[model samples]
Target chain A: MHNDIASLINSSVPGANASVVNPPEDGAGDSSVLVDSSKIYEVCEFLKTNDKFPFPVLQVISGVDYVEYFEVCYMLASFNLENSYQLILKTQLKDRENPELQSVVPVWAAANYQERECYDMIGVRFKDHPDHRRILCPDDWEGFPLRKDYEVQKVYRGMEVNPEAKMNFEDREFEVRKKEMEADLLKRQLERGH
Target chain B: MQTWDMGIKELQDETQDESMNTELLTVNMGPQHPATHGVLRVEIKTDSEIVAQAIPHIGYLHRCMEKHCESIDYRGIIPFVDRMDYLAAMNQELVYSMAVEKMLGTEVPRRAQVIRMIVSELQRIASHLMAFGTYALDLGAFSPFLYAFDEREKILRFFEEISGARLLYNYFWIGGVWNDMTNAHVSYIKDFLDNFEGELEKYDTLVSSNKIFLERVNNVGVLSVEDCFNYGATGPVLRGSGYKWDLRKVEPYLLYDEVKFDVPVGTGERGSTIGDCYNRYIVRMKEMEESVKIIRQCLDMLEPGPVIGKVSKVIKLPKGEIFYRQECPRGELGIHIVSTGEKTPYRVKVKSPCFTHVSMLPFMAPGQMVADFVATIGSIDIVLGEVDR
Candidate 1:
């Protein structure tokens, strides 16, 4: 199956290969393979066309964010061969800034909602997706809530939804800023009057 | 935009219109409607009676069961798992147990395996009964629901005697079942199986054989085998499309490999590829009988032994990851467990049957009649709690 997948991916796209993962101890000998993001479509095409590793069903599409790079995983199940495999596609992204990837919904229609969910939570931009709006949250929702650095004490749409302890600190900051702004305004008004 | 009028008398004539095209009307079906079974809303666009498009709106019943499971202990989360897909509670519990067992490498006793097989098959029957009853009502036949409910009550009686509850019975534990059945429970099941055939005939006479029900379900939502595979459909939905793929036979969990029972598959299309609502209905109806056969065999082979394996008071699964899938009534229900060698699971991801089933609706529901849409959804047998979870 690994060789078949390798040949399939190699034949379909240039510079695409499958690397096997060491099987976990005391577990099913299920192997994982890594793929380049640039050749994802070629791999997808190969799986759909080839008989041995026909990725007929897309089980799940989730994003695993490493600090340096983002791993977009696609779990494909082959009914023809009665086996399943995972395709981990990695792409480096700027840290603290959202990165974009092409949508695989065209390859498998089932990936539409899953990708949207990935985008909503992980803040990955799925390029050219139809209706790439936040699915689990409102449209105007800020911050990728699932990100490790995402602050829990965040304000959105004029509502202070964070904890009361944080609210005290935020309130003190707000009062200090308000006083400074008011003093600045008074100074400006006095100058204008002069 | 322009207003047109010839005279006061001529304005009375409403037939003269320029917008000749008839547009598809959008109808929001339910966040509250009865047929939805729960808070599932499908935004449907229709041209008169035929559905132009359908976009299923889920998340209404989303309890975040996956995230919730991570916070609770492994043993503490079993009851909450039962509520996800409330119909096939035993199967839900079993899949979780299978995942935990796979992680721990626990071997359940042969006696317990047989008992698990028996209860799982019985739960399949009960799950199919709910599906069939609700499917009948969706197609405008109320009598079948009543008759099906009546038959289901007998199964519930058996369930109550075994586990103290009717629905949502958290019977299956990690290593084995919570309790072993008595002779009375075994005999009651035998009697129910004996009478199930006669009761199924009542359903055939009341609903399956009825012309109206047949017309509504026969070729309404034709999901091909290719579509079934593509959408990750399993259980009766896949089997109904002529795929002889049963996890019990393929994966052979518990004592299923030892059991001698036929895999009931649909003869799709022209006795081969129909894959329509009727095929799904017929497959489930036949599967109930098949389940009964397995149950009868289990009863004859029943042996007395300890029901549970060596399970710790605190189920601290070894630090590992295991994805266990089982053939549930609707489709494949899976539990992906990531254990950190702790009392609580590190992460729990449930691959719900209805999640895959409902994903196929946007494609299947279009080009179907508005009325047939409900029938098609019912045929899919979606429990929205599972979908939204």
Candidate 2:
């Protein structure tokens, strides 16, 4: 669906590199335009100022860890559906060790807390981000929770975040889980009037 | 007593001298303060009565919801979503369900759609009532709080009857609601809507249009339309900035396209700035009325039919990303779903309105009186659960 808008971004903005992230025939859900990580800031500026279709609002900014690469999604929308309603710009950062991307906060101030949150959850650093500190997590938090390989630390400041202490339950985790599954199946059957 | 009088006299003398500089004080207003509405803490820099800057500190209630959603299957996410904005949990569930339904490309049954619209609008009224009640409390009027919640309790009673929970109703599902509405649910809503206007007009005469309330909030903590959009403020915050934009009208998700309702906006009436605390509060007040109208229309259109579409228990969504936005009671609640053809979502990014609304406090809090700070926060009607989530 975004194939048209992705091609439009390529032709309109000078030196703008953009492509559809997941075209419908090949992928699931709606498609979004993936812009070059380095030039994402400039592309956002263009989208904000472009006369033909001004996406005045940066609706939200989110991050997705694809294991191999970290992808950031910038959701943009025009006020009142002026020309085009929405255009999602995504940037992929292949650097797994220390992922960094330019900040679009300069274009949309809405990107301020959202980008910080993306960093807090996904660990993707935004260059030129004002006060780029952790938004939702503590400053000393170790690993990004949203990452695929994320593991809970044994202790958070000496208090066990992953508690070793266990309650005296009638059953272990999988045992209780099995019972819950059976109950759910029976409930579904009853709801179906079987 | 003499020493205390000398201290007060010195303060009065300092006020008399225009040349005398007041000492700047740094005040931390609640990671626990009652007027803050929740556990939200704002670090305010003030000189005498005027605020110089405010930096809001959040994450006290962070449950790492997005992180948790990665492992949970599609259906289980609803209960978790309901907890995010507990005040407007139906709105939260509705938006999340809509996002998943969009990804699955499933059509919600017509009856299900009507009931969803009914609950969403009813939840809107309930949410605005809380906003009105608590905002009145923040502004130092205790009576309206009682009056507002009295009505809100009635809404909650029926909501409890239908959804089986009072505060966090996980009633809405992906393609349908959990339970079908009975005649009891319909009559409860109708009775509430019937008496709602008389109560609303009483509130209007009592607090919203009151001279004293206007004096406290009229021109205080104003945000222009440009500042509002730039910071991504939505719902009453955006509409109160004199923007007539509502997602139900513009985007028209669910049965919003079929419904007839007017989007209430702030017009700076009664000697107030376009986007002041007064405008924001009044917009929410007017929206409750519009919600009533929408609910009446939806109730008339209601008919007997199935409430759910044919969807499998464990839906394996295809590999793609979807960003869906809807107008919640607080503002625009957006769900960005990244599926990897699995039973569980790879990534579910929640774009909460309070998160953005709280971010802009620094923009609005400066240059206002120190007392008006709570007024500004209350006007936005932030539920810290959603803010931290």
Candidate 3:
């Protein structure tokens, strides 16, 4: 059903280059429609308004970094009205330096802050996003913290970011944790008949 | 000085006139104020007694839950997820376990599922009690807060008996529970429910119909059904808008399909309209009864079996992404994990209801009284820990 909706979206909506991305071999997740980053706003608008698949509620917009590019996911569901459906929309931006995507705030009001969060965590700026500022971090805070290559700065206004950075295995708490972990592993192995 | 019958633009055009003296007053309501709840600070722009805007500024309690999940192992992320919404940690753990169990394809034992249902319902009652306690105090009704705490303490005691910790219990494992629940625990839960039902009736008479509480919440901060959908509201907030959509009833995760429970939604009864603060509180109040019903059913369904499922030593998620959502006390707590066939997740994104619901403040706050803003904030039942996670 989700694939049929994706194909309908790909064919009906003009400039929509959406392709269904099937779940991997593990089958952990549902199949998602990967749309072009530039045409995401239209695809999302169509998804909400179209009669065939009207997924009105925009739930979460998450950003993931793949070292070379960023994948921005839009999770939506039709919990408000009839035709209950949970759909995922993905758009990948290969631009490492200035990753950008169209904002879906026009489609759903829930997109307002979630889009800000996406911009805050992974540095994926949403085009035409009103009040597009850092949400979880201060405006002056440097670096996208969620990115795999993100580096923590040595100092923020001379305050120590990591106060216990020099902690070694010789520390009392560390030694206690190591002992407790070993005990837990042994117990788990016994339970598994290892 | 208050005799301007013209609109805002006309008043601005006549700003040179001395009679129109009032300007928009912007007040910061807190990263510390009591009414704002936790570290949520709302910048309220008011014109006289009415609010023009209420911009919520969060992130004071941001703990980088996603960043930590990226580095931690699968089982290790459970306790970390518990802190996201500390009030209802069981539900959080349950949802996270469901996600991980999906990755590993682990089917939980029957007894474990029943125990999970019972404990999560108990946690819901406790969480809603805290919500009401704080919400009533926000509206200056202290007696109800005290009553709520007394009952909440009992639920906490039950939680302590099941798991060691009172607040954040790391009991629900990926495959199943940490330990099996004894039969004695079941009878104790039944007795607690018998007493709790009477206490709930006492509360309905004590505060639910109180004139002042109704005056503070009724018709104030009213959200239309369209506003709810557009704002992506869920849980009681969506239910308060007269929507009967519940994940338990509709989606039915973790043996909810077999259970018989009526999802109570806002009806806009004689005194209060739908989607108002009054209706929201009433929805939660009535939900406790429904929760009690679910727990009674779980007790009958409970059977003797192993608590934990068969899980391997080294757990790794395959290269894929999955989203698991469940009905939490606050709203839908979903965990969307993207993996790379590694020991740790590539990204763990949480869709907390507070984050979306709090955004509705700016939409609902305009044109309401400044005092009602407190009622509005409290009515949303936001936990900043989840909002800023």
Candidate 4:
């Protein structure tokens, strides 16, 4: 199914270099097709309008940071076809500092807020989005919070950035020891046949 | 009524005058208004009473759930996922657990699958009950709000007994459920189902068929089929637009395929077109009954077995990216996880239904009366926690 989608994308869309990737060995059941970042808009337009595979719904747009590069994934589903199939389209950005890709909002209206969220979190800019402001973060927030190197701000507008305290290592260790002691006591009591 | 009629004529005469210029009024609906549902603020441009354009401002409740997912372990993300859609926490947990389970190649036991389906459907009923109650409250029907919440309280009590939490339940785990269900819990749910059917009919008579509600909602905020697809509406919003696209029937995740239930779409039974606010309200009312049918079947299929699958305490997923979606009460809740074969995830993205539903306001709000805009928001059912997650 993925190979058919890749070849169809390559032949139908201009300037698109599409190739299918293998499905995960764990049987997750959907392989992805990598498309050239420059031609993603045209490729998405073709996939959405093409009679063979009219993927009417753009289910999600996810952004992933891989340190050296960034990848934007498009999860599309077709309700028009008899047997519905999900097409995963991935586009890679080699430039870490300025990662940009063509927006698919023209093809799918659902991509509007999802792309803005991707930009706000992972710093992947989508060109030609209608309203490209941050969807989830404040407009003044610095750095993409989801980036691997980004750090949480210490303060915002005079208020301390105090996350609810997580258990420290010593606390965790003490809790583990307490559980083990209780288990040992229970085992000993069972062995006594009382 | 006579004074309102005279005022309309007087205002019309004033607007008709060449020298009298009418200016568009900009009104800020919320970040705190009860009718806005949550912390949603819309800057509405109104020409007299009809809205010209509405621009929604979100992110007021932003919590950066994606960033937290990168730091937390694969199994530890369930509680955070539950917070996204606090009303339907079980459904939210089910989607995240399924995504991680798929990446790890873990096959959940048959009994656990049935339990997950039953719990998720019950959560849907509870969530929809809240939607119904709050929607009525927004429309100024006090009695239905009390009645709806009274019925919803029973479902919450059932959730409290089964999962030990009424609102935010971290009951579902990666491989399976956190705990097994008891016979008493099953009987409690069965009892609720039997009594709730009659209550639903009473609710229908109380609110669904109310003449005032029909007049207020019918033909108001009508969304065309084209607009629905173009704006990526799903669940009841898309179904209300007369499209039969349901993730349960179309995608059929988990044991949804085995369960026999009808997908209720709007047929314009009221005096308006199919995709009006009234149709959307009816679609939710009908869906509650279908959920009851699913829960009954799941209870019948429940068996005694190990709930949790055999997985190591320290969980790790293989390097890949997977996007899993489920038919949540609001719409389609999608979780996209990018793994790097590490304990912590590389990236996590949530496709919240409320976010997309809220985005469609600019398209639907124009030409609608200011009061009808509240009905539009109620029909779409936006939750700020999921929207700003």
Candidate 5:
């Protein structure tokens, strides 16, 4: 797969290198790919158009923000080749006010909503989206909720957002954990067929 | 309880873009319409019968599952995930669990993989049943809807026996499943398969090959293969457009690589030139048969073994990040988990296919009749829960 990808990239595009990023074994290629964000569109175009990998399908596009930088991943699948490939394009949206990224809508029409969502949640703005509006949230909604720094919400659109919204982790706290344990004990007591 | 008449008129006025003198008719199809499986309001702008634009106004059923996912225990979040794409509950759970498993580096048991295959295919049949039923309803054919429901009920009954709930069953666990498949479950599934082929023929006669249904759907809302790819269409929607990109076959997760099943793709001028509502419907109807074939192979391979792999009850995953995805009935349902070597995931991101699927609406909905827009939407099969989540 590595040789095929490298040869494919080398043949299709100039100065394109597709090294094997075996992260689990080496963990070196895990954090970042040695590829330019600007080159993503070109590579994608090549993948979709060229003979090597006519990956006509952009299956899923998602993002993960790690405080300092954001990791925007694109999973591309090929219909003709019958193979799947992941293109993790790294982009840093430094400022929260206007986090902008190049829109892949031109590359894959399916990207309009995924980009809008990345905008709505992580606040990454796609520069050339046809209708880049607040999708999940109301039009005038305040901040991107998915970012690590932003507060979840105490109030959203005048509704009282959960007061414990900020520190609301999925796991139970000690007090609630104790109560659940007690409830389980009581249930077990009631279930005894004496 | 606000009436729709005033809303409809105001919607019409807005459709005219007020500034433009052209009288644009605005019509509200749902929020109560039967064709809209749930409370989905489609604000359509039209001149005569031709729809100029269609804007899907959702969030009526928005419980904010993303917020809920953030607040609940990663494991406990499965049931809510199940609710998002209710038709593809098993697939939803599979994607979520795969993310958690990848983050933790916890390998699932082989037995569990077989079980996952079984449930996922079952859910596929059930989800296709929904598409078939809803597509029928869109075409003003109520009988096919009932027929589809009858088959879907059999699958749901099997789910009820296995998971202890029918609609929103969180049967798949993080490392494995809640429980093993019972003998009764297997037997019922086999019986359903035996009767389904005959029933499917009824569907062909009732709706699929019906002249009215084909006339309503064929050459209507045509989405090309490029359009499907660009828009990130998945499942039957993508397949219906002549792209044979099934995640089960391409990605080969679980025991799918071992399984023998065909990715039945749409063909001909209707499939090529007119990848329309009927194409998607026909593709899904054919997909149900493929799913049935996959399920039979999975069931035959099924044997008694420990369903859950060896993992601590309080799972403290390694500090790592992994993105896991599955070919959900909707599209590629992905779950990205960033672990901090704690019981809870540091950050969990769900990439719902419906989110991307609905995004294509603004692109697909123009120039078709308002009724055809409903049919196209139904053909695409967007679950609002998954869309909003």
Candidate 6:
């Protein structure tokens, strides 16, 4: 499956530096191929539309920040093929600050929200993406929260950014309430005994 | 008398002409509305009553689950996974645990696999019941909602007995389940399954065959096979388009290959072509019966053995990435994890099914009636918790 996908990507997409990589010993069932970030869209389009490697469903697009660089992984599965085959296509981005890649939404409409999520979390910009915006965060929110160096803001709007506000209850108050309840129970038991 | 009749006819003609010149109206459906199922806001453009277009705006329930995964260890993420799709928390826990297990190259015990199958199937039934009841409520039927919830509450009782939680069960661990199921709980599930068919029959008579229900759902919000693929719609929504693309049959995970069950597809039995709202409803109804079949087989094959596998307490994954796909109740729940030989995951991306379903709303909602819009949203069976996460 890996070789077939590699050959298909090589033959169909010009200037796409694609190569099939040997599966890691602990890697799950499917094999993966490393493709250039610029030609990811072309390779994906060919794989999705080609007869031999018809990976119709784009399952997921996950972005990972690896300190030195960034990697975007695409999990693709086929429904039209004989036995369903899963394929992984990884593209590396060297520029971590303004990472950019071609969008595959024109090939698979499912990429619309997933790409936006990648951008929102990892700060990867997909060129030519329609309706590109922060999906899970507010429009006015600051830095990408998923990045390793992202620091929580002290305040947003006029409210303080305290994590304690999100807690269900404070420890001291809960302890005090428990003591009060125990005392009341002891008084009731003594009265009943009398 | 003739002059009076002419005057009334002329007034009627003028009113008809005015009604014909309709203006487009934009309406907001959610972010707080009960019919949307959760905090989903759909900006719908309509010409009087027919929707010209509908754009869904999500993120009201965004909890930044992926970001949290980066800080928490593999074992600590199960509770967070349960919160993603609160309706099918078992299945959510199963997929996350399975992914982490795959990354660690650990083998799950046979007993644990069987138990996972049983619990996951039960969760499927419970999730479908929620979808069924809520879909009925969306269509203005009040009785079926009560009837469906009555059955669902019984399933929750069974889950509570086994996992000690009614809704969000963080029971499924990375190597195996949190605890073993007793004979008493097994028998309770068996008894529930035995009586479930009768309840389903009652629902069919009350809602499925009712004329008003049929009129509201039939031939409304149709999705073509091409459209389903383009939009990446899965589970019942894709099955409703007459595609036999079930992950259980196609890419059998866990012990799904051992189970005998049918994949129900849309046959256009409700006087409409395949992929309509009615077909999606019927597919879910049929799927519940198949889930019962699977659960019965699992119960027969279940044996007494160790539930949790032998693994290190502190899980340190090798440097690699893997994408695990499970046939979740709503659709294909894919978990993509990237590890850097660390205790915590480098990146964890959950490809939630409802998120894709919500994305397809813009494509499905145009040219549909404003009232049918509710039926369309319900037919897709999206939980906003999953979508926003």
Model 2's interface RMSD:
1.7
**Stretch of 10 with least lDDT, candidate 5 chain B:** B1-10
lDDT of 5 by residue, B41-129 (tens): 78887766667777877667766666556545677788888888877888898888887776566788888999899888889889989
Tell me how far the alpha carbon of residue B292 in candidate 4 is from the true structure, in angstroms, after superposition.
1.2
**Per-residue C-alpha lDDT of model 2 across residues B257-324, encoded as one tens digit per residue:** 88788988889899999999999999999999999999999999899999999898768887788888
Candidate 5 lDDT at B6 equals 30
Clashing pairs in 6: none
TM-score of chain A of 4: 0.81
**lDDT agreement of model 6 with the native:** 0.86
lDDT of 4 at B31: 91
Docking quality (DockQ) for each candidate: 0.15, 0.59, 0.63, 0.41, 0.30, 0.35
lDDT of 3 by residue, B212-257 (tens): 8888888888888789889889999999989898999888888999
Sequence-dependent TM-score of model 3: 0.93
What is the C-alpha lDDT profile of model 2 across A1-194, one tens digit per residue? 47766676788766668877664565557667888887787788888887766788888888888998988888888876434388778888999999998888888899989989989888999998998999888889899888999887777888878454664454468767976997899799899995
Per-model fnat list = 0.18, 0.73, 0.68, 0.53, 0.39, 0.54
What is the per-residue lDDT of model 5 for residues A77-179, given as tens digits with 9 covering 90 to 100? Answer: 5555444565443444456565566787788876777777777777777777888887777777777777778775556768876656665565457758876
lDDT by residue (B1-389, candidate 6, tens digit) is: 33222322343354477655556688999889878999999999876566778888889999999888887788889999999999999999999898888877789999999999999999999999999999999988888888889999998998888889999988999899989999988899899999998988988889888899999888888898888888888899999999988888887888999888999999998586799999999999999999999999999988999999988967988777778888888999998887767888888889899999999888887767778889999999999999988
The docking category that best describes candidate 3 is: medium
Question: Candidate 6, TM-score vs. the true structure?
Answer: 0.90
Candidate 5 whole-model C-alpha lDDT, 0 to 1: 0.74
A1-194 per-residue lDDT for model 1 (tens digits): 66556666676667865555434564442345666666666677677777656677776665555546665666676654255443433333454475877787777777777777778667888888886876655567777654545554467777777657665787679868976996799799899999
Supply candidate 3's per-residue lDDT for A104. 80
User: Measured by TM-score, how close is model 2 to the native structure?
Assistant: 0.92
Candidate 1 or 5, higher DockQ?
Answer: 5
Per-residue CA lDDT of model 1 for B1-389, tens digit only, reads: 12221221233233246564456689999989767767888999876566768888877786656656766788878898899899888989989887788777789988888898899889899989998998888777787889889888888888888999998888889898998989988888888888998888878778777777776777778888888867778778888888887877777787787778777877753332378888888899888888888898899888999999998765777765555678888887877665657678756667777877888888897667677788888888889888777
Model 5, chain B: what is the TM-score? 0.91
lDDT score at residue A189, model 4, on the 0-100 scale: 81
